[model samples]
Target: MSEALLIAVLALPAVGAAAAFFPDRAGRLFGTVLAALAFVASLLLGAYSQPASWFAYTPAAQGAPPIVPWTSVDTPWVPALDLRLHFGVDGVSYPLVVLTTLLTLLCCLYTLWHVPTGGRGSTLVALLLVVEVGMLGTFLALDLVLFFVFFEVVLLPMYAVIAGWGGERRRHAARKFALYTLFGSVLLLVGVFTVVAAAGTADLVTLTSGSVSLTRNTQLAAFALLAIAFAVKSPLWPLHTWLPDAHTQAPTVGSVLLAGVLLKMGTYGLIRVAVGVAPEGARWASPLLGALAVAAILVGCLVCLAQTELKRLIAYSSVGHMGFVLLGVATLTATGIQAALIGNVAHGIITGLLFFLAGAVKDRFHTGDLAVLGGLRERSPWLSGLLAFAAIASLGLPGLAGFWGEAFAVVAAFERGGAGWVTLGVLAAIGGALTAAYFLRMLRKVTHGAASPAVAAPPLPALRVSGMELVAWSPLVVLALLVGLVPAVVLGLSAAPVQSLVEAVTP
Candidate 1:
């Protein structure tokens, strides 16, 4: 039953993608309906799915407990190489799966009212569905080769979306995006193969369970490969140059999904693949990872302060926000991993809202330049109000969803036990202050000022918030508030799995 649900969650979007070849209205309807069904299916699976193994495997060591994959599905696809089709979701993966489906559904709903300026609405929807398949499959996949296949599957469709439908510089951004991530893919492939060669199997569950003993040196080398790959995707500071370009160039829905589900893939990989399978390597690398995370936080915040374009600023903010997530992972404590998990979801919800608002602003003013976007409050109260709300939430205000992740990450870092981590924690807290500074500056510039000449000039179509826009954004707002008020909602889901993961490495 669980495997069937997982398959439905994975397959429905694919089927919708196929069905999207129909004419525009029909295709949009079909795509949205299918995405909605997948969302429901994901929720049901998370609520009721139990731990169970779909494939029979006897432990190599006598008296060892059998390893069961939650909501697992397995099938033999290769014999000689021992690769197989395996998929499952644990406590850690389930919320992200739900998040992916929810955001995809909202994007599809938004399309119903506003397709990109391009004519091929059907093709656009199909590309989104394809990206959904890749994201969902990545989170659910339990085999290394299968995970890589799903991971790579996300690249081309996204590139097509950007190149085919993005802004003036779309072509360059798309090409750069493809080149960077593909290069990262190469590193990931090498790491996957290295681990497979050492373990003699590609089963993620078994390898992470410590069934395959890996020496410290091998773990470090393999982890380095994997880290570089995931970092490009998670886009830790130096590797992050491609992201602002990609986000700024991509269309509204494209930016929404890119911020929402796509970025989580990298941090998810760090937890699920890099750290899960190579704890010793993780321990060795935690300091470096934490340092890089701090750099991302500081750098991303400072970049935001200097940005002229709203979307570009949001893009850079993701770099800083994800830094918090990465820092949580680097802490290597139970609370830290849990903080990373919630932070992943929080960044998704909060940043997705920010990008959506940024797109709306661009749509209204025909510009993303903050210099010309003043007096949003005078021109459109609805838009300005929402923008203010999202920006405040983003600044890690005490009761909002953003606060818990960074706060806990700082706490975890302080408690991570080492002089170096204590220093990192202090730096991270300073980064949080920088986060507030930039966001407050942005809010003042965009929402609180008199209308600039460009904004005072009448909107092209008498700009007002549409019903469809509200429909798309309402969930993000509510979830951000929900998670903020009751963080336990997200924190609870990953606690046990994170505890177990911490145990795996604690020795």
Candidate 2:
């Protein structure tokens, strides 16, 4: 039943993508239903029974495999390459899989009511479904080559979404996004073959289990290739130039998915593949990685401070937010990995809501410039309130979804205990302050003042919230509160798997 659920999760979306071209409203409704079903299937993937104490913090027994998928399906795919149709999920990946499905459903539902210009609604929905399949497959894939295949699958469909249904600069943004990630994909392909060639197999479970011996030099090289590849997707520091442009020009749903689950592929790969498959390299590079993550945090916050455009500012914030997640992974401890996991889920929820609000603001005002927007509180109280809530939550307010990952990331770094790690922790804490400052600034500029010319302009549609918007945004709001109040929602499931991974990588 679990295996069937896995297959259903992937298959439903693929079929939906195909069915979405069936023309008009029928196709759009069909796609939305399939997306909803896919989300349900993903939820069920975690429903299988386990030992009563499976969530306990006890270490794995000696000689046990670091990763044990709760449900998996494996079959031969390419004999010559030793590849197979291997896919599985454990506590570590289940939350992300569910996140991908949920957000895709929301995006699909959003499309049903409001399709962006330059494309049919059905086509946009189709592209979203395709992206969902790639993301789900990437998370569930247990074979290295298969993982790479799924990773690359997301690139083109997302590119099409941006190019076909995005803003004025969409083509440029789409091209830049494509070129940047495709470069990463090239490196990713090389990294996959590097490990497969050296290890003589493509199974992630085997490679991560320490059954295959890789020398330090090989590990270092493979880790470099894989880390850089994932970094571009993570858009770490210097490699992140493409993201703001992509987000600035992408349509609402595009930005939401791009921020929501797409960036996660990189961080997830960093934890599950690069670090898991090459621990020696992760250790060797920890200081450098930690330093770069700090750089991203500070730089992203600084940039956000200077930004006038709403979406662009939010886009830059992701750099800092993801920096926290990467910092957790760089610590290479159970607390750190678990922090990173929750961070991934938290960022997806909060940022997805932010984009939804930003899109609505842009849609109504026909502008995203902070200079031209104000008095949201008076003009549209609910929208302003939701925006304030999302922004505060994003700034890492205590007792919200955003706090756990950033706070725990700092805690994990401190726990690592070297001078450099301590320094990274301290600087990251400062970045947290900078985060608050920029968000407050954004709120003051966009939501606090008297109505701007744009806001007060005549002939504008009523500021009243639409039912569709309420339906779409409510889940995110609830999730931000829910996950914040009960972090165990993500951390509980991830604790055991994270402990196992840390143990595997610990020298």
Candidate 3:
């Protein structure tokens, strides 16, 4: 039964996390095997599993529909107010659950040989496995309290990775990252409690099935708390200050996963929790959200043009890319919503690759400073080629995975069923142009240049790209090409769900 799959999907990495603490070299091998199995399982789930099986999870409530959670697993640890151990998965969660599993496995595989953690490779691998549990649970939990528990569970491990295993400023970055996310977590907790207190059920499925009404004031207030929490996680615009520092400081695998998968949690929360549960509030706030998105895109693009540090430039690019996701949500249309979804996946893969190459560049030449690091193309052609490909992809080059998300987002913005959305579309188009310009400039400086004297002069042999590194990275690159060359794969999955969401939100 699919229920069994769910248990394995979550439990497998967890089991690995535990085994990974065995304090031996086999810890890495054990973790790799477990992670690989989970990744394969996730692929099976996404490619072949039926939605009927996925929605086996049904939330319990008095006003709910007749269908029950056919295969839920719960344990009663508290009965005073009806909170207990609860776990489930549903249609809305299908893609994310699979993504979390797939990427975590890749991260585990990547860390096995290429990690830069402070002589604590096994411990770092264990932490990532633990982080996987929190990620999977966050996407699948039906109960509000359970969701929050999983949501907050990821904080400490990530903090340790950034602070304990990070670069020179790791500790400072860790502190700042913890403080920012914790601030958002507080707001999210308040919002979750408000929902439970008012609606009397922490069950998301039940809330989705029926209608719940609250006054405008309460809706707005609760919306702020929930949206801010998601936004901080998404690291949208002003609250986005934490991400660049975190990315700049974390190791390559950490940066790849952080940029690729972790940030999607925030946007996923925006759609799954904020808009899905708080439609009225979402409608009220659409205009303002649109404006902030536009500002982020513009600001993110402008800042990228000024960056001499390669990683920081891409870090800022995340700010711009997420602006598109917010813009899609602000529109509240099927097309716009789908654009956001596709954009989320695209950015994760493309930017994740970018970080990978950035780290590789650092590892090769000993600096990500664009100034000192000239002629990587000559010194290391393979690294140069990979960086170029990812750079083009990140800038939304046509016929690649990045193009569709930005292109349609602009189209949706123009026809986003409102004047506000139209404005966002225009601003985003400008951001797109800026994206192209900055990336072209970046390519010139890093990947396509005359070698410095050292690079041009003889005796220094070019750095070699390893086989395992290729295995670790090529999947994302291939996907970026697949989605770009054949966007239908992504579009087909998102179209129906987005249609449902847009119909619900449209006035």
Candidate 4:
């Protein structure tokens, strides 16, 4: 039954992608329903994947394999290359899988009401479903070769979404986004084959479990290649130039998914693949990784402080937010990994809503320039309130979803101990302050004071929030509060798997 659910979670989105081309509104309606069903399947998969014995299960013996999927489907796909149709769900991946489905569903529902000008709503929905399939497959794939296949699958569909349904500069943004990620894809391909060839197996479970021994040199090389590849996707530091452009020009749903689950792919792979597959490499590179992560935090916040465009500010914020996630992973401790995991989920929730609100602002005012927007509270109280809530949540308010991840990442870095790690931790905490400053700056400019020309130009009635917007934004708002208040929602599920992985990797 669990296996069937796993298969269904994947199949539903795929079917929706095909059905989404079936004529007019019917296609969109069908797609939304299918997305909803896919989300339901993901939730059920989580429920079923939990062990029946739960508290009674014992830890694996020392030097034994750590990866034990609660539910998995293993079958031969290509006997010649030793590749198999291997997929599984466990504590580590389940939350991300569920996140992908939920975000896709919200995006689809948003599309049903307001299709961007560049293409048909049906096509946009179809492409979203395709992206969903790739993301879910990435999270669920347990074979190294298969993981690469799914990872590559996301590039074109997302490109189509941006290029076909995006803003004035969409084509250039789409092209740059594709080219940067494709470069990373090449590195990823080389890294995957390197590990597979050296280890004589493509099974991620086998490779990560310490059953296959890789020399230090090979592990170092593979980890570097994989880390850079994932970093490009995470858009870490110098490699992140493409992201602001992509987000600035992408349609609302495109920005949401890009910031939401798409970026998580990189950080997720860094943890599950790079760190898990090459612990020695991770240890060797920890200082460098942590340093770059803090750099991203500070740089992203500084850029956001100077940003003039609304969407662009939000885009830059993702860089800093993801920096926190990466910093947590760089620590290489159970607490750090747990912080990274919850941070991943919290960023998805808060940033997704921010993009949604940014899109609404752009759509209504016909401008995203912070200099030209003001007095949101006077013209549209509810919209202003939602924007305020999203911005506050994004700035890492103590009781909001964004708080735990950033705060814990700092705590984890301190927990690691050492002058350099301690410095990185202090700098990251300062970045947290910078985060609050920029977000508050954004809110004051966009929501308070006298009305700017752009804000005053839009009729008050026109600024009123639509029902469709409410439906799309409500879940994100609730999730920000829920996850913030009860961080255990993500942490509880991941604790054991994270402990096992940390133990396996620790010298």
**Candidate 4 segments whose C-alpha is farther than 4 A from its true place:** 51-66
- Give the TM-scores of the predictions, in the order they appear: 0.95, 0.98, 0.92, 0.98
lDDT at residue 408 of model 1 (Cα atoms): 90
Cα lDDT tens digits, model 3, 1-507, are: 666676787888888886546664678778878888887776665544454333233223433332133345566646887887666553446666766776777777777667685756777778888888888888777677888888898899899888867889988888999999999999999999887777787776665444656566766777888999999999998899999899999988778778888888899888877776677788999888889988999999999999999899999999999998898888777667777887888898888889888887777666788776677687778888988899889889898989887888788778865676676788899999999999988888886677865445444443787777788789888988988987666666555445555555555
**Clash count, one per candidate:** 0, 0, 1, 0
User: lDDT (CA) for every model shown?
Assistant: 0.88, 0.92, 0.78, 0.91
Provide the lowest-lDDT 10-residue window in model 3: 58-67
Span of ten consecutive residues with least summed lDDT in model 2: 49-58
Error of 2 at 298 (Å): 0.2
Q: How big is the RMSD of model 4?
A: 1.7
Relative to the unseen true structure, what is the C-alpha lDDT of residue 141 in candidate 2, on a scale of 0 to 100? 97
Clashes of 4: 0
Report the error of model 3 at residue 479, Å: 0.7
